[model samples]
Target: MRPSPLLLALPALSTAQQQFPFLDQVKGWFAQASNSISSAIPSAPSPPSVPNPVASGAKVIADAKVQPLTKDNYQDVLKPGAATASPGIEEWMIFVTGGNKTCFGRCERAETAWNESTALLSASRSPPNLGLLDCEAEPVLCNAWAVGPPTIFHFLIPQPLADQSTPATTVRSFGLNRTTVTAPEIASIHLEEKYTQKEPYEGIFHPFDGPLAKAGLAIPVGYAIWGFSLIPSWAFMIGVSFISRSMMSRRMQGGAPAGGAQPAAAPAAGS
Candidate 1:
């Protein structure tokens, strides 16, 4: 029987495939046109190696209206102006601290308490400003301000008080005694007047250089006791002593045996 061309080509193809493996693949590729044709060949020009951002470099553009957030601009945003400013009117809570082992922690705790209290107070309005001071560092200032650490002094309606010429009677530090002093005693000294020589609270400060300055001018509280009541006491004591002495002398004379005057016998016997 005679062999067909396709059958006769098998040996040559096998030899060619043996000589070149890639040609065998290429021949199969040519013979079979399937979805894998394009996929089988690759290294595909790498899509022109998309340009690197760094190598190409970025461009600089100028904006006429926009400004960079420089410190000056940032400060401008925070800068206080009349329109946006909180009023100078502020109830200040000065948290004074001393130099002690627990002072730092104690002061911090006091500050927190003050903040909470003031926050509560300001719930209906603006809160008072908080201030911290080291009493050890500014003793003179504290003295002048009549402020003691851990002591509370409320300046109620300061605006109205500032308007009045006289001292506001309401302006006073909380009265303290052994019973009232807070535990872990933060302050012991009490001041009722201001001595801020540097910058006195202006019209708000009340010093004792007034008419009542010389209070010790012998001003009597009531009846001037010139040791007069003592005179009556002395007189009564002297009278009592005189009567007692006289009675004692008479009794002694009478009791004497011969010279001593005895009790008189019945007058009838002498008659």
Candidate 2:
């Protein structure tokens, strides 16, 4: 006699279970393949320096100073009102001294005069109430001092990778490999420039406010796709196996033998 549909399905059901071990192995292989693929792509290289306009500008500033700004003295020049008054100025000075170096230094005497003079100039041009008379003569001297030299203005502009020569390309390629395997050194320098112009918290806190914030948001989405695709196929296989077993057991019980008499009728009625 031909077997019922439920019985016919049993062989298929058993085959599925037997095939599970192979399926698990395949899943492991897939995971390994995915890891290898992720490892294959080389990291982006550090940006090649082809004379950045901004850095050049900074170098010009450094070159003008009598002394280069060190970590210890940076605070002196960076402070507001640093270049003011009779004794010493309490302000920031961007000066260039050597050929390509820019320095920021605190000059108590010169800065005071410079600040007072600029204030006077500002006051003279604007409303009468804006002028500072304490060191009004200093701006004139500073201006005269600034006039004698042929000041070089260096601005750092990003050098595009497409414009560089073969040697530059080779260097950049190696940098990219380092960035991929190690920390992103080149990218970090670019980030420092960005952070210098705008505060770090500004990037993190203001999502709709700036370009950096938008770029930051985009980077994580790419990572998420890679991560989810790596989930093992065995999880699905296990769930399917559980469901099939439950269904088969129910069908088997329903088809069990029913040949026994009905408990002898329980001695009912008149016998």
Candidate 3:
């Protein structure tokens, strides 16, 4: 039997579809529409790329506005109206670091925050001066500041420069944990409390700096020592006596000298 007429038409249908006569026309229309839409809509320029603040150590340092304080220049900068007062600094916040190896990590960590805070402060309307004091470089200055490694000390200008030591007393300290809040935020908070709120000059930082803290520690230690002292004199002697008796009993039971040989009766007469 002959193949069906529909099967015979299949090849022609395939050839017609393959030609795709309307495809180019459809593409042209779509391209024109796309171009019109694209042209009608305003071209949006790309947003500017913002730099990451803490990108690298060098970058952080570059962005930092901290003044390096050495023995020579520290006094001039930190103290206002001194014989060599820095032109603009009203008061100072110093980042003090020491020579201790253990503090190296802390110092390195705190440095980034310190640098960042200084950068932020630099941008502010009433920026306070920030400085860095390397205790290793200036031992005398660090001793005078009474600061250890990785410490941040805020100093207020004393009314009477005669009270040069007043700033030391009023100086508040930020410890290693200051890195948690870090930079502009932490610096701003401190500034707010110090300047805006006008918190009183407590002249002390950690509780350990206070007499009560010392008393607290001392009381416990003293009590322990006193309790030990109150123990009867004979009580200690009892342990010693008991130990002595035990050793003696052990020796007696062994029935032998430690060397497993008794000393010959002291070389009796010319033996």
Candidate 4:
């Protein structure tokens, strides 16, 4: 039977559907399904806003910069108002840090004590900024009177580069690898083990073996061949058969004549 008009129209309709599927109202069904799914779930509340332009700019600047610290460009990060000198910005903080491992423990104890002491301020809704000093990376303020590292000293920067009052002359320090100690000193001091950074078992190799990876991967590799000969694929089998057939002919041609015999010589009288 001949095809019907409706059947002939079906192909054109399918072609048009393939070109613009939305014309077939698939998007309408999809939108309805999406709406149903969305309506079933409770609406999410709006996110709170936090101004982060300065943060984004800082990130970009940090990414672009690789400036090495030198005497010429060293800035006093400890200064309370060291960020800018535009007139009235008060940046304040209690920096808790140690110069070394021994100092680190003391600073941590101090941090715990300070947290305990400031609980009242937190309850009253007034909390101060606190920072951990990166002792090695952060150069100490040159003019501040510090006994040495591994100590807690207080400082405030009221104005930009102004002759601020001298910082406290004396500060308490933690155990600094105690060079000499009496019986009384040994009795008073405390000690404990701290191993934050340590040597790794595998050394520095990563992603693969280090240094000798090329030597390790120098093995012969192929889809249809190995070190000695072609691997047993269809192409290899075909070539081997052809060479074998030619060699077989040569072998047959070089063979001794078939079905031929010679008479034995007469035995000597001694036999």
Which candidate gets the maximum lDDT versus the true structure?
A: 3
Give all candidates' CA lDDT scores.
0.40, 0.34, 0.60, 0.37
Error of 1 at 10 (Å): 77
lDDT tens digits, residues 1-271, model 3?
9999999999997787679778678879999999999999998999999766464653465345677886466545655455434443355677776555425555655666666666566666666666777866665455444457777666555433465433222456665563464675547745565444444335322222334323444334434544565589999899889999999999897987677776776767977
Per-residue C-alpha lDDT of model 2 across residues 1-271, encoded as one tens digit per residue: 8879998899997898697778778879999999999899888999886965644553343234223333233224333223432222111112212211111222222323322323222333221111111112222221212211111111121222344421110001111121122112322323232224422222232212334224654224323533444567897689889999999998997676577334554776887
Pairs clashing within candidate 3: none
- Is 1 or 2 the stronger prediction by lDDT? 1
As a whole number from 0 to 100, the lDDT of residue 62 in candidate 1 is 12
Instruction: Give stretches of model 3 more than 4 Å off.
Output: 1-53, 56-64, 82-89, 98-102, 158-169, 178-181, 189-191, 194-271
Question: Taking the candidates one at a time, how many backbone clashes does each contain?
Answer: 0, 39, 0, 0
Q: Using Cα atoms with residue i matched to residue i, what is each candidate's TM-score against the true structure?
A: 0.27, 0.19, 0.43, 0.23
Instruction: List clashing residue pairs in candidate 4.
Output: none
Residue 263: error of model 2 in Å?
99
Residue 245 in model 3: shift from native, Å? 32
Better of 2 and 3 by lDDT: 3
TM-score of model number 1: 0.27
TM-score of 4: 0.23
Best by TM-score: 3
